[model samples]
Target chain A: MTKPTGPSRRTFLKTTAAATLAAPTIVSPSIFAKGDTPAPSDRVVVGSIGVGDLGRRHHLNNKLLVNPRIQVAAVCDVDRNHRDLAANDVLTKSGKMPGVYKDFRDLCDRKDIDAVFVVTPDHWHALVSIYAMETGKDVYCEKPLTLNIEEGKKMVEVARRYGAVFQTGSQQRSEGPFRQAVELIRNGKIGKVQRVDTYIGNIDAGKWQAPITPPPELDWNFWLGPAPYADYFPNRCHYQFRWFSDYSGGKMTDWGAHHNDITQWALEKDQSGPVKVRCEQAQFAPDGPHDVALEFDIAYTYADGVELHCHSQGKNGIKFTGTDGWVFVSRSQKEFDAHDKALLTWQAGDNDVNLPRTETKHPHHDNFLDCIASRQRPICDVEIGHRSATVCHLGNIAIRLGRELQWDPAKEEFVGDDQANQLVGKPMRAPWHL
Target chain B: MATVTELAGDLCSGDQVKTYQAQQALARLSGEIGASGKEAEKAEAAKALAAVLAGVKPAKDNRGEATVDSIKSVNSANELCRALSLLAGEAEVAVLAECLKNIDLRETARWCLARMTCQGAADALVEAYKTATGTEYRVGLINALGRKQGSNVLETLKLAAADKEPEVALAAVEALANTPDAALDAVISSVESGSSSRRAARVARARVRLGSTLLRAGDDAGAKKVFTAVAGADVDEAPKKAAAAAVGG
Candidate 1:
């Protein structure tokens, strides 16, 4: 199929000019146009995919139910019990029963559903999001954006091709302190930035889960959709799936999705990444159950001479050091810190750049809805998500290969190293073509 | 903060001196080779590349052959394809597939498409092969598609195997040799009918290879069946011996 052309350059230029001059928070009135009358028709109909922990608790019960402007039209999960629970919760809260589906495609096919909240496993992220977009539904996909680097690339391309407004679940982008830290860095409060230190946590290794029959409530095949088929075990399916490379990228991508994202935003390098990546002091379990790194320090160097140091031993946050000063912030941190405490009080002038603002339980989710109405790009768009995820994936590659690799960010490739480039995009099992 | 559009204009300027400078400016805007550019900058470069591909004409070489020699001479052809790959989709794939007809740029274009994350790229190659008039060019496109993995290209390979041109059909058969069960089934059926095996020796070898895939998948029964068939086939001695060894017949 031939790709569709985007809006003309002239149109893009005009829209950009308007966006640049507008306030940091740009919300289209159509999102709440019917809300003035408070009618059901006016409410944005949203479907919640994967009614698991975050899907049920944070997304459906907390945010979607609480948001008056949104109506939870559908809840889908491969696990029958999870979907039923979510549907029941929605009914109890909204006094209306939501349509339940065992398959995500059924949810996407609904004409009433305007958008989908994909809180599925990392491996399913790109497929579900792409399929939803292909069905003409906007998506708020959870991070890390994809299971592998190739999947992320495909997600970005397909999202744009279908004109879908995609928001990655990198909520750090929406947090107040994170934005403030980025703004401070952007305004050069930290002088010419040189290095950034990000600490998320250690990787999980040397743990094995014996194969067990999948629970009756779950459709193991559907759950393992694009991921390689494997014998089911309790630990390999749910929250613990993060420990497996086939399902997730361990803590490197898990927490790195948030911290590396902020690092990219602060460096204003969301479209690109570091040129060279190296790992030191890494160890791994010989056999499976969980096969991620034990511990390591990863170093990434940008062509323009900026450095990013990621390790597990440091404070659990990002510390940006520049010529003059430094600043640090983390989700777990009670308060943000700067070299000079007064720097935290620095406000932007009329001419200073202000990143977009989001203040909701899931700011990125709210941003997705707003962008769906405005036909604008969300704060953490698919491309930005892909780039951020690429950083984490690179760290994993460096560790796994036990070597330093030169990366060409512009080409999104490892420079002249066929072996390294091979890891950039892995082959999927049969019947699953991305 | 030079706009990618401005830099792209410089790149397409035909003047050797100005074009190199323009390429440098575009490279810098993309944040050197090793660095990452801003989102806006990346977007602009993508747009600029699209526009250049659409409008920029090929330059004349010293031998007066109409070629993109100006860009190729400076190693910018690969660079252009890389930039295009960054923002590539079906549209970019179509353009690159068309470039496969250009012998000078075919390798670079294939390399560009091979590295892309877009799945439509494989489909584009198949589409290009069907439409490609020249037997040689069609074979080249088939060879390129051969290196691609996935079942997406399976049907295309099967179709190409039926080509009236023996060369094209042979190339398609050669490509199908490494495919899994599905493609193997098609190859086996074609060989049984004595149509796909114009080069009979390769078909015997492919059968042996398919049988090997089954053996590795732990389907000894199916593997033995395939090997027995190849061993029984009225073909070359080499393939018969190979199949006999596989089945220990």
Candidate 2:
């Protein structure tokens, strides 16, 4: 579905004001208005799929549970402890018990749930999000969107087919500074774009640990889901899973999904990708729990003649260098700046381009809810998410194959490399095929 | 998990779930078996697959709900074909080539034939491409041959590159692009001297993209050469300008 050409601020305010009179449950015109919580009917009913580590800290605790605009209706995770903790946390805050589900499928089947925040391991993203969408639920799937290129394609197809509102969890798209940076670049605040340099953290060269029995709280098989089967190793699950090829694409996709995503948005290349990808240098462990690139310097060439250089050595953010100036933004640094400091402070003239803006402090989930109401594509639409993730996946594939690849962005395939095409759609373990 | 033999037996099972699981397991094991350490072991695995295919026949049983049952059957056949494709030999290729007639199995059968290591694989596909009447099937076969990994397959792709069907020609041209230095030159020649404006446009786009990639990688001279070539071609203005931009015109 196309991105919604949302109403102007004045029209949105007027429409919401009228809507508030007809439905007292509508939140006030000021989203962060302090007076009162919106009526229960006005709240977006959200369920959370994974409640472990980052999911709990960022989405469940900080956003879903605390946000008055959302009512946490259910919590699902393979781990009973994490699910129970999340449900309890919601209960304490809202004084209402959320349904606890062992299987995310059961959570999706709930009629009370309007949307789901899919924070599962990378392998489960497509399955949970697609199923939820098919069941008439909107999805806020965590990035990187899918385990393979095929999965992402299927996800985009199913979401559109079902008319589902989807928002990928590349939350940077919602941040004010990122939007401002992209706007500046899009408006040519930096003269004709030269190159984008992105730095994701170095890969963790982990060795395959001896197999250990899974803890009682974890349903290991369910967690593995569509990925190939492997014996249990604690580090190969949860937050540490990012380093493994089986479950994740290492830090390249982990952080790359975020920074590389912003780079695509700034370049206005979200619908397309680089025509060529080459991994200049990389080191992979001989055998391991992780087989991703330990160090990498990959280069991509877009059809428009712009270069996107990705590496592990540079600052852990994105640098957009244009002929006039360059802007650098890093999440960890909690700062964004430009070569000419004045560029950061530059204001757009009346004719200058301005991207859709969101309310200050409005978390990404709010954007998902807003789109659900508006029936529009979110800031990080499924197609946008897939394209960005494709960039990261291409880099990983190049490094692993130790060759430069000619990519047909229109076809979304390696020009003629049968071997590389084989890696594009990974074979799922039985009963889990897409 | 069932052994390959056990799963192969279950392939003929009446229960749909068992059959599905068996198909998946066999397909997975075939890839492993094809790559097994011992050559004799690999050959035996391929033979076992041939035996399985010889006995298995496509069921024409039309349930009232054709969509659901057919979808299930197509999916199962897809997995079965995948298993056989990974391990097919000369004998297996013949069996898979025969499967190309079955509408539900044709795509997967062609895919299997392409990936088979049998010496006859490419020849079998070229023969099939000649006899195949359906445009989609011919296109599939052309793509399969295009993906083959040798110089021996280039002549067949070159012939298909001149096919009357634009789709067929485009597929062959795409395959030519995949070949290292030699075949790419052939593709450029075909496009440069060819009469099809559409095919020429496609080739020019790829050529300009190559130039753009070269420029991005800091190879100014290489980029300039690619851009210079395409800039003079009968391409749309967009690619010409893109080429000039790559050369800083």
Name the top TM-score candidate: 2
Q: Would you give me the overall lDDT of model 1?
A: 0.72
- Model 1, span A133-239: residue lDDT tens: 75668888889998778788768766754557788989888878898899899999989999999998985544455567899999998888655455687877888
Cα lDDT tens digits, model 1, B44-71, are: 5565676666454445545456444644
lDDT per residue as tens, model 2, A168-210: 9998987767777888899888898889999887865565455
Per-residue lDDT over B1-249 for candidate 2, one digit per residue giving the tens place of the 0 to 100 score? 666656666665544446545654553354344332545665676677666655555546565546555554455555566556555567667777777766656666776676565568887787677767666667778767765666557777777777777767766765665454432544644644257544555566556544544554676676677777766666745456555655566
- Tell me how far the alpha carbon of residue A295 in candidate 1 is from the true structure, in angstroms, after superposition: 1.7
User: How does residue A218 of candidate 1 score in lDDT?
Assistant: 98
Q: What C-alpha lDDT, on a 0 to 100 scale, does residue B214 get in candidate 1?
A: 71
Off by over 4 Å in 2: A1-36, A332-335, B1-249
Q: Report the lDDT of model 2 for residue A240.
A: 81
The segments of candidate 1 whose C-alpha lies over 4 angstroms from its true place after superposition are A1-38, A203-207, A286-288, A360-362, B1-249
Per-prediction TM-score, chain B alone: 0.65, 0.70
